[model samples]
Target chain A: MDNQTKIHIKNLNLHIGKQQILKDINVQIPKNKITVILGPSGCGKTTLLKSLNRLTDIYPDIKVEGSIEIDGQDILKVKKRDVTDIRKKMGLLSQRPYPLPMSIYKNITYGLKISGRRRKRFLNKRVEHYLKQASLWDEVKDRLKDPASALSIGQQQRLCLARGLAVDPEIILADEPTSALDPVSSQAIEEKFVELKERYTIVMVTHVLRQARRIADHVVFMYLGEVVEQGSAEEVFGNPKEERTKAYLRGAFN
Target chain B: MKRFFKINRKIRNTFHKRWMLLSLIVVIAMPIVLGVGLYLKSAMLLEQTSLIKLLFSKEWKPMQGLFGLWPFIVSSLWVTILALLIAGPICLLAAIYMTQYTKKYFLRMMHPVIDILAGIPSVVYGVWGVIFVVPLVSNHLAPFFNTQSSGYSILTGAIVLAVMIIPFILNILIEVFRNIPDQLTEASLSLGATHWETVKHVLVRKAFPGIVSAFGLGISRAFGETIAVLMVVGNVTQIPKGIFQPGYPLPALIANNYGEMLSIPLYDSALMLSALVLFVVVLLFNFASRMAIIKLERHT
Candidate 1:
C-alpha cells in the first residue's frame, strides 16, 4: 500500500499441470526504479516475470491463484477482452530478441498501428524517437526500410527494445534481455536500462549476480521457487540477513 | 589393434560413401529417365503434325487424324484454377483457426480426420461427386443461377476436385503455420495485439513463402487427378464457355481413350503426348515454385 509501490503481489501461486512453478510469492515492485529478480536457472525467475503482464495466459493448463495488483488494480482478475489493455501498460523484452517479420520501420510502428495510431507523420516521428531511446537511431536511421532480420544480433535486440518502447508502456519487464548479447551490446543495454529507469519502472530477471550488483536498485533473490530474500541492493549484497543469500553470494551454489 | 581398427573403419566408410552415392545417382536419374521415355513414346505424333497445329487447333476428329488439344487444355486450366480459388481461402482459414484459435485437443481430434480424408481413394471421391455434388449442382445451384444444364459440368468437376485436395493443402498449411516460432507470436501478443491481429500480422506474414509452395504442390496434384475430375466433367471435347457447361480435361481424354487408341495409327502416340504434357507442366510448376520459395526466403 506504499505510495511508491507500482505493483503489489499477494499470495501468488502458479502451477503448470501437476507441478508448481511459483509458490506463495508476495513482493512489491517500486515505481521508477530497477528491481532485479536474481536466481539460479530453473528457479522460475522467467515464469514470475511473465506473470506480471499476464503472459502466462498464453500457455494451456496453467492455473494461477493470486492477486497481482498494479496501481491498486488486480491484473490477474481482468477479463480476457481487457487483458490487452493491461498488457499495453507494460513492455516486455524476452530472453532473445524476436523481431516481427517486417521492415525495421514497420516493427517499431506495429504496436502504434494496432493501438489505432495511424497518422503517417506522427508514426514517423515516434519511430525515430523510440530508436533513439534505445540508442540505435544513428546506426539504423538510414535503413529503416530494410528487413529487421537483416540487422546484426546486437542491433536486432536494440530494435526489439525500441519496438517495446514504442508502445509507450509505464513498466518494462525484461527477462534476461542481454543473455544472448555480446559484452559490448550487454553493456549498451545495461546503460540504456539505467537511463530508462528514470521514467519507467523496470523489473529485470537474470542469474548473473554481477549484473544485478551493477544496476539493481532493489534485489529479490529466489531459490527453488521461493523468494529467499529481498531488499535494497546495499542491504542484500553488502550485509545479507539470510544464510541462503550469504551462501549464494559466497559462490557456494549456482 | 588400433591401426587394424582404423583400416577396417576406412573400408567401411568408403563402402557407405559409395552406397549413398549410388542412391543419390538413382534419385537424380529418375526424372531424366522418365522424361526421355515419354519423349520417345510421343515423338511419333510430334513428327506427324507440327507442334503448333497440334496444340492450338480445336479439331478433334480421330478418324481424320486431326488432334488439336486446345479444348482439353482450356478445360484443364479452368477446372484447376476454379478448384484452387475455392479451396485456397478455405484451407488457409481453417488452418489458421486450427493452429491459432483452437485448443490442443481440438487439433488432435482433427489429425485423424485429415489423414482419413487424405487416405481415401480418388475413385471414392469421384463416386461421391457423382452421387452428391453432381445432383447438388444440377438441381439446386444451376437452377438457382438460371443455368439450364445437366449436373455434369466444369462446376461439378471443380467442386469435387476442391473437396479432394482440401486435406492435401490443409496438411501442408498446418505444417507451415506450426513451423513459425512461438517467440514471434509472443512478441506480437506482448505488444497488446489481439490473437487474430497477431496471427494476421505475424504468423500469416511469416508463413507466406511456405503457403505459396503448398499451393503450388496442390495445383500440381489437382492438375493430374484423373478419375475424380473425369467422372464429373462432362467429357465433351470442346472449350467450356462457362462453369455450368460440360468440358473435357486432358487427363480424362488420356485415361478414357488409352484402351482403344492402339487400333488407330498415331492414336497411341497422341495419348502419350498428353501424358508428356502433364509431366512437363507439373515439372515446370514444381521448379517455378521452388525458385519462388528460395527468392522469398532470401528476401525475408
Candidate 2:
C-alpha cells in the first residue's frame, strides 16, 4: 500500500531434517500491500510464508537461522512468551479452509474470546463487520449460528478469511489460499484481497503465474529455494531480470 | 504363465469374498441367537414372579425363593460410576498428551507399552488387583481418607477398573485426536492461540463426539468387567455405604452364583436376567455412541 517497509526477512535459511528448504533468502515486504511470493510447488514458498509468523516453530526438526523483523522488532529473536503477541499482529489463511468445528458465529468469536473479548454486543458487531469485509455477510447473515462446514467451499473460504480478520491483524499471510477454489470462488477471493489491501498488509503464495500477475502489487519470484528477482509487479512480470524468472513466466516448467 | 496368474488371482478374490461373508454371518448370528435365548429364559422368570418384585425388592434370598436385584443393580451403578470418574480424566489427559505433546521417541516407546497393557488378560488383571491394588487401597488410600477398610471394597475395585480401562479408552482417544487435521491447529495457532488453547478450543472441540463415544465404550467395559471387579469388590450382595465398603456388581453376582443355580428353583433364571440386563445396558451405550460418531462424521 505504501513505500514504507513493514517486514524485513534477512538471510533466512530454513532446513527440515537434512534438507534445505529455504537458502539464504532476503526480502522486504512493503506495508499495507499485497506481496505475492511466486514460485513452483515445493520451492519453499509456503515455508517462507510460515516463518514470517513463526508458525514453522511447531516442527521439531525444523532449523531456522536468520532474523525476521516486523515493525523494528526481530520476531525470530523474541522471547517465546512474546510469540503469541507477535502472532496476534498477523492472520493466516491456509490452502484449505479449516473452520473450527462449531457454529459460524463461534468460529469468528473464538479468536476474540480467547484474546479476552467478552461482551455480547461487541462480538455481534465485530462478527457482522468481519463477515461484511469478507463479502459473506449477506449470504450467511440468516444462518450465522449454523455450522461453518455447512457452507459451500467458497463460502467456507470466505468465512475462514472473516475469522482471520476478526482477530484484527495488521498483516495477512495466505498460503495458496485460492488454489483449492473454483474459478468463480478464486475470483471472489482475489477481489476480496484487492479490497483488503487498503487496510491490511497481505503476503500471498501462488504458483499460478496469471494469478500472480493479476493480484500482485509487489512480486518476489523464487526458484529452487532462492529469490531470483523481486520488484514492483509491473517490472517483475513485464521485464523480469533473471532467466529462471523469465523461463517460469514463459511456462517452460513449473 | 499369464493365464495361470489370472486364475490364481481369481481364486484369491473368491476366497477372500467367501471368508468375509462367513465372518459377517458368524459375528451377527452369534449375538442375536444368544440374546434371544437369554431373553426367553428371563421371560420365564418374569412370568413366575412379578417384574416389580424382582426389580425393587431388596431381599435376595435364594433359599426362601426371593430374586430381588436392587442391591446388585445399585452396586453396579456405583462401581461403574466410580471407575469412570477415576479413569476418564486420567485417560483423556494421557491421550491428549500422547497425541499433542509427546515426542516421537517417547511415542514410539509408548505404543508397544500401551499395546501390551491392552493385551493383558482380565484374569491377569484380577490377580494383580488382588495382590497389589487391594493392599494399596486398604493400607494407603483408605487410611489417607481416614476410613477403615479390609482391602476388598468398592473403592479398590474401582481403582483396578480405572487402571484397566485407561489404556482401553486412551487407545480410542488417541486415534480420534490423530484424525484431526493439522490445518485446524495451524489455523488456531495463527489466530494467536497458545498450544494449550488450540487444543482446548480446536482439537478437543473437533474430537468431542469421538471422545464421548470412547467414554461410552469405556463405561460399557467397566459395567461388564467380572473377574477384576469380583476379586477386589468383596462381593457382598448389598448396597455399599461408602467407597471403602464391599459391593456386589451384577457381573460378579452372576459369576459367583452360576455354579449353584441348578440347586435353587428360579435362581438360574435370575442370573440369566442379570446377564440380559448387562447385555441390554451395554448394547444401548454402544448404539448411542455409534449414533454420535455417525452424526459427527456426517457433520464434518
- Model 1, A35-110: lDDT tens per residue? 9999899999999998898888877767899999999999998998888998888888889999999999999999
In model 2, the fraction of reference contacts reproduced equals: 0.62
Candidate 1, residues B174-260: lDDT per residue as tens digits? 999988877788889889998889888999889999999989988999999999999999999999999999999999999999988
User: What TM-score does each model's chain B reach against the true chain B?
Assistant: 0.93, 0.91
Q: Which ranges of candidate 2 are over 4 A from the true structure? A: A1-3, B1-22, B296-300
- Model 1 DockQ reads 0.64
Report the Cα lDDT for candidate 1: 0.92
- Against the reference, the lDDT scores of all candidates come to 0.92, 0.90
